[model samples]
Structure formats: C-alpha cells, structure tokens
Target: MFTRKLGKTKIEVSEIGFGAWAIGGDAWGPVDDGQSLRAMEAAVELGVNFIDTADVYGDGRSEQLVAKLIEGRRNELVVSTKGGLMGHHRDPNGEPVYGRPAKVIEAFENSLKRLGTDYIDVYFCHLWWDKQEETEAFIEAFKQLKRDGKVRAVGVSTENFDYIKHFNREGGLDAVQLDYSVLNRSVESEVLPYLEQHGIGAVVRGPLRMGILTGKFHEGTTFGEGDIRRNWPKETWFADSLAKVETLKGLVNEERTLSQAALRFVLNHPAISVAIPGAKTAEQAAQNVSASARPLLSDEDLSIIARVK
Candidate 1:
C-alpha cells in the first residue's frame, strides 16, 4: 500500500484505508464479530495503516471492534474517528449537536473509552450543524482537544463544501472527508480544487457509490433488512446507476474487477489523499488493499468513466 502525508500533520497514512462502517452491524445488515476482526487483521497484514470510524457508527460498536484489532499495536496504525453526532443505536442517522465545549469534550471522552486509546489521530467534526456561530465554537473545542493532547489532528466530514472553504480560510481544519466516486463527480467542480489549493488532505468516502459501482447490484436486486441502501431516494436512481455501471464494466477485464477499477478511478485524482471503501470480510479487505497496486487509470479511462451518464 502507498502512503501519503495527511495534510500538514506529521502522520502518514495508507492510500487505501479500512472503513469500519460495515462492521458496526447496524445499517449495513447483519455481520459477524469474528469476521470483522479477521477483516481488520487482513487489512493490517496487507500494510493498511489507516482506519476511519465514527462514534455514532453502530452506536460505538465499530469503534470497539477497531480498538480490539489495534489494541497492543497502536504504534503500527493511525486511527481516525469522528464525534459530535449522537442518536439512538437503531437509527443509522444521528442528530447534529455541536458548539458546546462540554458536549464536545464528553463525546471525545466517550470515543476514547471505546477506541481504547489516549489520543485519536484525526478527530472529525462528523457533520456541520449549518450554524456559523455554532460551527466556530465547535472548531474552538476541537483546538482545545489538540491542546489537551486528546487529538493529534482535526478534520470535518461534511457535504457543505462552501462551509469547508470558509473553514479552510480560517485555518480550522487539517483534513476534509467527502463523498466522491466514479458515479458522483459533483465535488470535482469546486470542492476538489479548493482542498488542493488550501493543502487540506481529502479522504474520499462512498468511493464505490455504496457498492453500486462494484457491479454486485443490478436491477431488481434486493438488500437484506436494516441495509441502508434500501432506503435510498428512489428506484429510478438505482436503475440509472446500474446502467452507468454497465458502461463502466466495458473498462474492466480479466486483470481488474469492477470494484478495483472504481476505487482506482477515485484515487487517480491528485486531490484525494486516500479512498476508504468498507470491507465486511477478510477477502474483501484483501481485495481493497490490492487495488492500490494497479497503475492509475489513464486519461482515456478517466474520460470514459466520467462521461458515463
């Protein structure tokens, strides 16, 4: 796995990080703890040093599992977890609660206990509450976390690119995590350029479009109970995405799988520091890490994937 510096921080993370969302066993459907551990172990064995999770994911289950895997080997990995969002375990979505220093500290403390670590590599804001004053207060609290040695660096995972641009202007964040992939190129128009210019590391989530780009789902495919994909906007969106995936399959052959091609397409962008694709099993973890071995997509390949409507 290739490594890159995480913005201005001294930490260097693997280009292919392990995303622990699925292991939480909440919105992604049923999962085995043993399998989750094995998958994390497989990722580590394959040189994956970065793992991203959140306090709200499975209501701390994900963080606990990640802590179990990296317990004694903390120095070997860089763990990035988020806070500031809280809610019931049964609900996949969490309520945004930021600004209050006490609440922020409490959330960080809880995450620390679950992660079994004294300091987090990168503690993200999780989501912006859309209130400028509250957001500023949240950033202040994050700085305090760094000053207290509870966090090494601070980041924000938000869809509000304009807010991110303003945050960057104020020198508030070291990294930004956003949804970006072959099927989702909305960020390319502005967000990518802004992050690149400001020197903030960008972590690409949903790089496979929640498995739609993996070619594992087709029309009429069904997800098990509790799978979040089942709640997606509309049926037409899925059908349209599947059609685009078909066009993308022509770009894949014997040497590469659709998932690998999809991941590589995201990494091909210079602004992306790493791409986090969730893996539920050991085999999936190994496959995700191996995607970094393939050469970057050519200009023509990128054009083909981008032009697909």
Candidate 2:
C-alpha cells in the first residue's frame, strides 16, 4: 500500500486505511466476527497500517475487535479511535457532557481499556460542539491526554471547520477525520484547505459515500434493516447520489473497479492524508488496498468529474 505522512504528527500511514465502523456490527446490519477478523488480517497483510474506529461504534465492539488486530502488531499499525458521544457520564440535561474535562478523561480511559492499549495512536472527539468554549475545553482535555502519554495525537471528527478552528486554537491539534468522497466534495471549500494550511492531517471517512460510489447501488437499491443508510431518502438524496455516481463511472475502465476509481479520486488531492473506507469482509478490504496500486486519476478524468455535481 502507498504511504503518506499524517500531516503534523509526521506519522506514516497507508494512503488507503481500514475504517472499522461496519465491522462493529448492529449499525451496518449483521456482521460476522470471523469475517471481520479476516478482513483486518487481510488488510494488514497488504500493508494497511492505519485503522479508524470509534468507541460508540457498537458500544465498544469495534475497538475490542481492533484490539485483536493489533495484539501482536501494535508497533506496525497506526490506530485512530474516537470518543465523546458515549454518554457514560452526562449532565442532567445531557447537554455538553464532553465539555467537562473529567468526562472527557473518563471516556478516554474507557476507550483505552476497550482497545487493550496503554496509549492510542490517534484519538478524536466523535461529535461536534457548537459552543466554542466547550470545544476549547475538549481540546484542552485532549492536550492533557497527550501530555499524560495516553494518546500520540489528538483531533476531532467533524465536518464543521469552525469547530476545527477551536480544536486547533492552541495549535495542538494533530488531525481531523471528516467525510470526503467523489460524491461528497463539501469539505474542499473549507475543511481541506484549513487542514492543509494549519498542518493538521485529514483522515477522510465515507470515501465511498456509504457504498454508492462502488457502483454497487442504484435507484432500486435498498439498504438492509440495521444498516444506517437504510433511512436515507430514496427519491431525494439517494437518487441524486446514485445519479452522480453514474456520471463518475465514466472514469472506470478495465484497470480498476468503480470502488477503486472512487478511492483514487479522493487520493488525487494533495491535501488529503488518507482515506478510510469501511470493509465488512476480506474481499472488500483487499479491494480497498488495491486502489493504492492503481494509476492516479488523470487531468482529463478530473475534468469529467468536475461536471458531475
């Protein structure tokens, strides 16, 4: 797999990393534990060193599964996990719970226990906070975690660049995880450029737009009951995304699947550090890693993509 520096942390990570959300199960329909392990092992064998997960993912099932993946290979992998939405401890109103430093530390400790690790490679706040003061408080809490040798890097997983500004107010932020795909270019206007300017790494999630860009879904596609995308509006957002995916398929050819082509399109930008596409099985994981070996998207292909929206 191709490698890239995770911006300010200077940590080398596979350009195509594994996103562990789906493997956590429940949220993405039924998932086989054996398949999940094989998927992780397959990706690791292919040199996938970066994996992103969240504590809220299956209520810690994801991190526990990842703990298995890194058991004997901790030094070889870069793991990024998130917290802040677990609600283990909350205010009476349950508002701004993570704004409290103690709660932040509590969430971190729980994540560490679940991951079976003494220190996390990258830890991100899993939700956004509109309140600037609360956001700054969370940043300070993360900075304290770094100071305590509990996490190597600190960031927030959010699409709000304004929230990101607060996270990086003191210039201690190391990275940010956000959704960016051929179908979701909203980050290009602000989030990507800010991360590039401020030297914060960008870990892109949803690079496949929840499997739409894989050309596996169509207007007739319907998500399973437990899958998160099951509730997406079919006639509106869903139809529009599939329509755009059809346009994106023009870049696909004999050399790569549409999934690989979509991944390659995301990696085409210099601003992006890594793309974490979710995989539920070994075949999917191998397919994601294969994108790193495919040729880069050409200027002509990009020109065609520009008109997709």
Candidate 3:
C-alpha cells in the first residue's frame, strides 16, 4: 500500500510487489493460468504497482500473464522484468547463458513483445556474468535500450555482493534485486549498506525464504513431484530451514500471520525498496498485500528472528 522511489529512475513502486515466478508455471510446479491471472488482478486491486518477472520464467509465459492482467492500465504500473537467461520451449532445465550485446538487444525485444509494452520500467540482467567484461557489455546494451526509450532503468540480480559493490562504485546500475529474508541475512553485512549509501534501490526476493517462513510446513512435509522443493537438499538445507521456521513462530500471534510478519521483516529495512513475494491465487495476493498495512517489526522482534540458526 506504501510506495518508495526506485533509485534515481523516478519510478515509484509499491512496497510489496508481485513476484511472477510461480505464475510462470515452470520451476516452482504446475500452475493454473486462470488462478495466476486472478492473483495478479487481486494484487492490482489491492494497490500493488510493481511486478517482477524474468524472460526465462516459463519461457516468457509469466510476462504474457502479467501483460494480460495490466492490459489497459500500463501507465499506472511499474513493471520490471529480467533477461539474459536463455531457455527453449523443449528444454526447461537449460543452463543460463550470459547475454552479449546482440543477445541483450534480442532478449529485450522478445520481452517487450511478450509483455505487450513499449517500454520496461526496469530491465535487469537476470544473473551476473562470470566476467566483468561480459557484464559491462550487457550494461552498455541496456543503455542503448534506454536511449531508444525501450527501457527506463537497468539493474542486476545476484547473490554476489562484491559485484554489486563494484557496480555501485562504477555507477552502472539503478537497482539491484537480491535474495534476502530473516533466515537469509547475508546481505545485511555489506550489500544493503552500500546500496543505501549510493541511492541504489534494493528489491528483495525470497523475502519468505521460498515459503518456509510462511510456517506452512513441518519437518516431514512432502512436496509434490513436480515442485521445485522436491529437488532441494532435504537432508540438511530443507530440514534446517524448517527448523528455523519453527523458531520464527513466536513472532506470529493475534496481530498477524507468520507470512505477514515475514514480509514486514524485510520491509523494515531502510535500504529495501520492495519485497516481491510470489502468489498463485487471489486469496494469497490479498493476504500478502495486507502485510503492507501492518506496522514494521520492532527491535525486539528483529532480535528474536535473528537468533534463529
């Protein structure tokens, strides 16, 4: 419900954005297009102006769905999408490929067509390239898009905080999306501080830790066959995450649900511009936006959550 400025781009976005990965119906599991559309519409109705999707998500299916939902109200929304990761219609598990200048141009064109938009508010390099040279080339290409009015801002999504620090130092990006949650505080050490100092907006993904922070599962919970969680390392990673979630239950009470507290925890940070949590149904969308209305976590609440694992 609250809005924040996205770096120096002059674009204002909702604090709780719609994460469109699950709506794409690829890595997460099977998805219903009807349900996804309703979820997106519900988000818009609830005042969500930001939507983040990737070109690789369901091979552009997510962008198409977002396009369908925001058909007549393009100017009212700040739609951000990523490119550079390549996937084919036949091969769903293909590896990501770094976008050279030519690839970057082609990817932007494809995403524009899929999203049915003349310009993207923010276009991120889906993942960091192995070489700085490659990343520079992509940023140059993104600048070209900006010059042509095809893209308004450029960003990068990555876990490597060092790359982010360098990019910020060089003034190469307008925003940075990274995985950050109560369970994942690695970004607090350096990445967050640097972004805040440089006036670079930070879009936090996995604010709910892929649903673990929602308190929806227990130790023995089983994921569906096609679910991406099935491939997660259950012996240590999954079990440990579930254990952390149990510890987080104390933060949830009559005031809010575990999911709501989890979202607010990420939003409490001064450096964070928005948190994108994925939803597949209208009820889920409503539940997520409700968190934006709640007060942020207190110092004691943050202390308690920080003690987990």
Candidate 4:
C-alpha cells in the first residue's frame, strides 16, 4: 500500500485507511462480530495502518472492536476516535452544549478505557462548535490531554471552515474529517484549500458516497432494515447519484473496479492525506486497500470525470 504523510502530524499512514463505522453494527445494518474482526485482520495484512472510529458509533462498540483488532500490535496501527456527543451536554434541540471542558475530558477518558489503550493517535471533536468560548474550551481540554500524554493529535470532524478557524484560533488543529467523493465535491471549493494552506491533514470519510460510487446500487436497489441508506428517498439525490454513477462506470475496466476508481478520484487532490472507506467484510476490506495498489486514474479519465455532472 502507498503511504502518505498525514499533514502536520508527520505520521505516515496508508493512503487507504479502514473506516470502522459499519462494523459498529447499528447505522449501516446487521453485522457479525467475527466477520468484523476478520475484515480488520485482512486490512492490516494488506498494510492498512490507520483506523478511524467514534464514541457515538454503536455507543463505543466500534472502539471496543478496534481494541480487539489492535491487541498485541497497538504500535503497528494509528487509531483515531471522536468525542463530543456524550453526557448531559446538549440542548433541547439535541445540539451539543459545547464549552464544557470537564465533560470533554471525561469523554476522552472513557474512550481510552473502551479502547483499552493508554493513548490515542488522533482525537477529533465529532461535531462542530460555533462559539469561540466553546472552541476555546475544547482547545484547552485537548491541550490537557496532549500534555498528559493521552492524545497525539487533535482534530474536528466538520466541513465548516468557520468553525475550524475558531477551533484553530490558537493554531492547535492537526486534522479534519469530512465527507468527500465522486458524487460530492463540496469540499473542494474552500475547505480543502484551507487545509492545504495550513498544513492540516484531511481524512476523507465517504469516498464512495455511502457505496453509491461503488456502482453496487441500482435504481431498483433497496436497503434492508437498520441500513441508514434505506431512508434515502430515491426521488431526490438518491436517484441523481445513481445516474451519475452510470457515467462513472465508464472509468471501470479490467484495471480497476468502480469503487477503486472512486477512491482514486478522492486521492487525486493533493490536500487529502488518506481516504477512509468503511468495510463490513474481509472481501470489502481487501478491495478497499487494494485500490492503492492499482495505477492512478489517467489524465484522460480524470478529464471525463471532471465534466460529470
């Protein structure tokens, strides 16, 4: 697998990292724990060194599973987890009541326990906080974690550049996770440029656009119970995204699958440090990591994809 330097952190990570969301077995659909463990094992054997999870994902089930994956080889991988969704720190609208330093620290401590690790490689604030005070509280809280040798890097998982600026007002941000894919180019306009300019790592979350860019779903496709995509109304972007995938399918050939092409497209941008595509099984995990082994998209193919609308 091709390795890239995660911006600012200087940690070399595989260009294709494993996103552990689906293995959490809640939002995506039913999953088998044995299969999940094997998927991660397959990824690691393929040289995947980075794994990103969240406290909210299956309410820490993902982190616990990750703990099992990293056993006896914690130093061989880079683990990232997010907080900011726990405790009684939310308003009536369910928006997080940010600026609570104590609660933030508590959340991090709990995550450490769940992962069965003394320190985390990367820690991200799962949600965006608009207020300056709230951002300052997080900065301070994260600073404490770093000082205590708990977290190596701190980031915020948000697309809002404004919120990023507030959090980085003191210049303490290391990375940011945002959704980016062939079907969604929203981050290219400003967010990506800012990260590149400031040397912040950009870890893409949804490089396959929730499997739509994988060309596995068709107009007649339907998701089963507990699948998050089941609620997507086909009358809207769901239908539109499927049409765009047809155009993208032309890039698929004996050299690569549609999913590999989509991942390559995301990695084409210089600002991206790594792309985390979630996999539920060993086959899926191997396929994701194998994208890095294929040749990059040719200029002609990129030109054709650029005009895809």
lDDT of 1: 0.84
On TM-score, the stronger of 1 and 2 is 2
Cα misplacement distance, residue 230 of candidate 2 (Å): 1.4
Model 4 lDDT tens row, 200-307? 999999999988888988777888999988877556879888878888888998989999989999998999999999999999999999899888889878876977
- Per-residue alpha-carbon lDDT of model 3 for 1-309, expressed as tens digits? 999998766889999999999988888889999999999999999999999999878988999999997799999999999986542211234422342576678878889999999899999987554466557667678778888988888888986877776555568689999999988988898888888888889999999889888888777677786688885656687888887887888898787899999999899889989999999999999989999998778887787787884
Give the Cα-based TM-score of candidate 2 against the true structure: 0.95
Cα displacement (Å) at residue 229, model 3: 0.7
Per-residue CA lDDT of model 2 for 188-262, tens digit only, reads: 988888899988999999999888888988666678898888877555878888778778888888999999988
The TM-score values for the models, in the order shown, are 0.93, 0.95, 0.93, 0.95
**What is the overall TM-score of model 3 with all chains considered together?**
0.93
Candidate 3 off by > 4 Å: 87-99
Error of 2 at 197 (Å): 1.4
Q: CA lDDT, every prediction?
A: 0.84, 0.87, 0.85, 0.88
10 residues in a row with least lDDT, candidate 3: 87-96
TM-score result, candidate 4:
0.95
- Local error of candidate 4 at 36, Å? 0.3
Instruction: Arrange candidates, best TM-score first.
Output: 2, 4, 1, 3
Off by over 4 Å in 4: 86-98, 129-133
Candidate 4 at residue 149, lDDT? Answer: 86
